[model samples]
Target: MSSQPTSNAPVLHVQGLGFGFPGHSLFQDWSADFPAGLSLIQGGDGTGKTSLLRLFAGETAPQAGSVTLLGMDAVRQPAEYRAQVFWRDPRAPWPDTLTPLTWVEQLPAHHPRWSGEAWRAHVAGFGLAMHLHKPMYQLSSGSQRKVLLAAALASGAVLTLLDEPLAALDKPSISYLLQALEAEARASRWPGRAVLVAHYDALGDLPWCARIAL
Candidate 1:
């Protein structure tokens, strides 16, 4: 992993964040500042990693507290804040008929920074060139997961939210992904930040990584 220095200003800030289901609390009174660069959030299974990501992505509201992306309150300015973030969940449902290229193009038109070539490159790096033409549902789980990851990285958004990124990949693919992620951060962007939620130990070796144990 390259040893690049990151800035002190937070690209993502969670203050007083709390979330839970009907009876139990997942995380309560939580706070964190994701400084510009890569941050790995590690926790055991059923420890609310996905729930926390959902709250951070604005997919669901937290019971209390707030998230700020690039200093813009995520709850107050969701549309604006979302423009700077890309959240990827491998299990997220998508129509079976959606092709990889079509899905990438479907990203909101408001994000003019999305790069088609970058996406193609990422897919190609994963040996997914042939699979792109196939419907998403026809591909194996690993292929579908790769597409999700490629789309998130290609978004060109400032803050990237990845849940279980290394679940179904071999060493070569994981290395390629790490390289791609690093290149994305070094490239020109509004506020580069990557919040990778994973149980995989290999992610800790990524360049400019900061560990957040929850």
Candidate 2:
């Protein structure tokens, strides 16, 4: 693993970022500085929470301005920038034929800090151990979400972008995820490591290093 950058430097820096759909504009000259640790992106529906995450993840390009992740241009150096982050869109379609275990096993190869033991532990912690072999289409919504969460947490990416992370989660699973996120923050294995969570509902007692509302 590479050494972490200075704590004072922002892990993610969005400067004058602008994006819009065909008929609606999401952000106009939006800017923010996200330091290491957990940050919450809270907003109601139609507020572009998911779009913002996609921009940060380099999955969507900004119409104007720039995004810098760990000193790399998010647009110009997309591959290098994205390689340091793990982003999973809840609304994105998945391959229904693949089993959760197979998906998890394949994703980590791209992540330099991938840990097989961590992946298995998160799978069990999120209550997906028994359903690992089942095709994704067969798993319940919550179970499918657990599979994705397990993969993201185990990826060990410096930047983790989670869109609507708390959606469809039961009480126990929510608690488990919260604990895991807290541990990730404290460990700080990657100096510029950050977890950016986009959600519309009240987080209620969850720990957050910073909070931004759109």
Candidate 3:
């Protein structure tokens, strides 16, 4: 993993965050500061790990408090904030008719750091190159997840939030992701980049910069 010295400055800062649905509450007065590198968000079902990630990604606004990334208020400057983040809900609805290649081709416009070459490499690493031409509906769950994973890794966003990333992935793909993330953590250009992944199960034997449980 990354042997580079980590800075104390928080790449992502959350203050008195709160969120809830009709009758269920997720977080209340929750606060934390995430430094650069990989951070695992561990929790059981209903613990709101996913909710917290969504909040950080600007996909869902907090009911109270605020989220700051690189000194920018997520709520006040959502477009700018989101531009620096890469998040894709695994269960998010997709255009069933679109191929993976088509979907990935549009990512560069949204992610300035996007690398088409990196995307292709990740696709090959995940054994997804062969499936890129197939429609989303025709691909298996594992393949679909790989497509998204490839995009996330290639986007090179300052902050990347991935929920249930290991789910539906094969052993080889999982290993590839782990190794890729480790390399990302070590990169000099991505010094302030932070990757947050939510996992329900133990991240046993996996290299992580840190872990936080909800």
Candidate 4:
């Protein structure tokens, strides 16, 4: 809805964040600012890329420090803060047995900026027309991930977090996703939205707003 020129200010701000599993520490005194537009969180396996995204999404609270989005405090105003963020872990199992169409239909209530037009466009672009009616568990791996990928693009949440976006995607689907990200980089798509992708490598020569090497 907002077509204003992108500001250099951080859409997502983090400070003094810390986290770790039982035996290993992932982050200590980690701090970073993520501006709106396409950005990459690049690292190899076991580098905590996904965990970092979880922290940004507020799904996994940091052991210390703070996170804020668009000046919305993720700690004190969690519901409001998280509503503006769109994040889904592709590695986890989905307990929702609904069809992709049904699942996406619920986005508007949770995501104030959810865009139906963008959803329709991405669904078509990803060639997920037929799979829309099928239960997510019934779809192929590629199709299942495509459903989530399309939702991530169309959710219109202030911050969209994508982990390993290229996984399970076919060649054509990958091409479509690349085009979408390129458009975002050009300021021609998903305006006013900050998207962070956690992956091992850059997908293309995108003019990323930020590049954090986890």
Question: What is the alpha-carbon RMSD of candidate 4 to the true structure?
Answer: 2.3
For candidate 1, lDDT tens digit of each residue in 36-116?
666778887888888888788878887889998767777788887777767867886779789987887788474566777
- Model 4, 95-161: lDDT tens digits are 5678997889888998877889888999999999988888788888889889999998888778999
In model 3, the runs with Cα more than 4 Å from the true position are 1-6
Candidate 2 per-residue C-alpha lDDT over 50-145 given as tens digits, one digit per residue, 9 for 90 to 100: 899999999999999999887788888888888888987876677878998778777767788877887888977888878988998888888888
The TM-score obtained by model 4 is 0.93
Separate clash counts for every candidate: 0, 0, 0, 0
Task: Look at candidate 1 and tell me the lDDT of residue 80.
Answer: 76
Q: Which candidate is the best by TM-score?
A: 2
What TM-score quantifies how close candidate 3 is to the native fold?
0.92
Per-candidate TM-scores read 0.87, 0.94, 0.92, 0.93
The better candidate by TM-score, 1 or 4, is 4
Steric clash pairs (candidate 1): none
As for model 1, its CA RMSD to the true structure in angstroms is 4.4
